[model samples]
Target: MSETLSGQATSTISAVVGRADVLIVGGGLSGAMLAAQLLRLPGRRRILIVEPRAELGRGEAYSATELGHTLNGNAARMSVDPDNADDLTQWLEAFIAKGGWPESDQQHVPVSELFPPRGIFGLYVQQRLAEAREQGAVSGSTAEHVCGEAVDLHIDSSGARLTLADGQCLEGAYAVLATGMFPAARTRQKHSSGLNAAAIDPWDVAAMSRLDPQGTVLIIGSGLTMVDAVVSLEQAGHRGPIRVFSRHGLLPHVRRQPPAWEDFLAADQSIRSPRQLLREVRRQCAAALASGIDWQAPLDTVRAHIGRLWSQASDVQRRQFVRHVRPWWESHHHRSPPLSAELVERLYKEGRLTIEAASLKGLDEPRDGRVSISIRPRGESRARTVTGEALINSTGIEYDWRRVDRPLPQQLLARGLIRPGPLALGIAADPGGAVVDAEGDVSTRLFAMGPPLRGMWWESTAVTDVASQAKALAVRLAQLMDSQKGRG
Candidate 1:
């Protein structure tokens, strides 16, 4: 083992600890894609990925064991490679040609347009990682997967020291935080007297299965997560009336294969505020509709420029946007797959599903194994009660790091190693994904990517954005490593 000091910091050396040139803290899609991209670089570097799960590349979103859960986007747009946008489509073609997937499961959609199950996508990611590893082996680069959870990180001038849940320590010259989506934080109950056990996790299919099949079910939030919950119930032979409640009661619109439109905002430097941007977008949508084109085409054009617009907006403008326009924007922009939307519509038409615009008041603890919920309907002064056999919280991923209950985040915050990003949405990081420390210094040895970058880029969670970030970060890290090697 060797140790070197840079500036005021000194790195301790321990010969027994595992070591790698680059260490990734999460083995989800973000970390796996980064590792894959790094392996393609022309250097022989040791890479270590620390993930508690037995499988890599399948995080909370894509690791769904339920068949009803599917990708929100089509195959053509979900490629892990930014340059090769149709790579997933090509992969799906090959997958379908092999005839291993059931014909009925295809849902009669074209291979390029199919929204495959999340589990299948997870497998594709794993396969890509494996291929990258094999290719790296021929070039002398090596990648190792460590099945462990990274609990804490200690950094010095030379590098970082990562402590795992299993009492193992790993040393690396560089560390990347690729931890993906966090679980939804518990909603603040108005009255906490007896509502402790009244809530159920939206993703817990097993808990959902235990509910009375014919009893009423209450789902909070009418987004994609709530759609997933409803699908799970349907797949489990549930015939109950489902009630979905949200502030806007806005369900995600169905995705369409719209033709590409001219990106008017791409060259417009004057659009900074949310109101200006929204106005321009509406005008473009109106023009597109007049021309017999889908409004989604113009929306897609706007989506391409969201990051730039967001970065240019002032903090106050951003807050205003979040408060006044985020809900409508999210519902229209981040849409559900066609099949999922069809399922939801069919259920609503059959009177099995009801969407309500309301604010949850509180839950009156379980009574006779059922819970009574208080809700105030939109434009109403009086609150009404609804009883359900089960209540599922589908409010979506928690963005505030301060509210996250994870040990790693808690430790990082307590030690002043990291600070919350804009609006406390996620961790603060530069555009290159290098994490900014509490002292406001950007760390060369520490970096981050994926969902943690939501504060930096509003569109960071999708596969396209993530894959592009991973590729760019990999190139940056590889160049940095090469420079250090030359100095050594």
Candidate 2:
């Protein structure tokens, strides 16, 4: 059964959704944006979007219903249009004028700076996709959302084929792996750490409400997801102690509007090594601070250059960066929203929340009806036990394709259709988003975008990244389709 956040999908009741010119494996934001881009282009191709959810746009990130669960970045930075940065700002203004998001006024910020709730953002994506559909209708192009989870994929000379969880089968001239990020709290990994099974989902606010309000809550990881878990706990009326554990215990910095800084990386082409880049960034940040500018201004300029630097870096350099710099990079780069940061700060000030630098060693039997775990401190060899009324795993996104225990990933790996990306971050793919097989051969019929290309582009999961990729990949697919037609 295909279920949406609101209800079940109403129209799809078939085991076979038929053939199309293009088959998108996942129908989240990546798939929806890709479909939207394709629909707007001049074409007469039939497209099939295979997804389990009834809704077309609300992926894992934007499906939150809580008011407290908001986007980390403001509207200005989260637009889905690659060419038009103000697309979301304009849409939000019109949406507000239509009497939507009545509570948005409480944010007391400009439309561009407002951190809209994820649910509202999902609606905006759906509306944009609706417009794309209307435009596509004028042409002979069309797309359908097949509400089913894709289990396995097969590629042959004729076409690419997909098998759904509910026994549905689909075919297309070519397929794209728009499979989005897999969050660690909810996904199944090959290595059974037993931590996820012992903990509650970080986003499930309803489950949090059942816990004792005054009991201590133990959390793992201190990144943006940990911030979200705190918001969930607070909204669920939990007021007791909150203890967070991670290797670095680095809390994300609060995102703020900063003045534009010079693009140091762009101007200085020699900044390729991680050490050199870090030193230059420090110098730039120091200069910014001395000039009374926000330090994040310098850091923001580095965002555009990550793909170039990462892709060109040697594997040894990449390892050095990951080993020594990853923690600080994540904490500074993936910042939390101001409101969420304020809540976390207030709780810390009140002595209600604490952070510890440690790593999970093992899970133990429940003690005194409380969840228990063993953790070793950063510089210590002794393992210590920590217990809580409830536990949450907020370790953030899992990018290692081999660790993901899903059927599709496993099948793809076994069939040599895909390979682990650089440093095993995500599946390896070529520059144009074509899937690179186990034998290092580029796939002609299968392509990838969004998080699946993390190895190729270090920052592939962001909104702007996905939008740019969607537009480019859509054009590539269209050209491929035209060539195939000519051959036929």
Indicate the residue-level lDDT of 322 in model 2: 91
> How does candidate 1 score on lDDT?
0.83
Residue-wise lDDT of candidate 1 within 1-488, one digit each (tens)?
12111112213212433578899989889988999999988989888888877788998878887766888888988999888988988887888677745652547777778888888889889889989988888888877777667888988899989887755678999999999878552444323333434667666778778778899999888988888888888877778899999989899999999998988887787888899988988999999999999999989878778887777677898898898889988899989988778889999999999999998888765678787889999999999888888888777777788876677887888877788888887898888999988999888899999999888877788888889999999999999999999999
Per-prediction TM-score to the true structure, in the order listed: 0.93, 0.96
RMSD of 2: 2.5
Tens-digit lDDT string for candidate 2 (308-391): 999999999999989988898999999999999999999999999999999998889999899999999999999999999999
Error of 1 at 306 (Å): 1.1
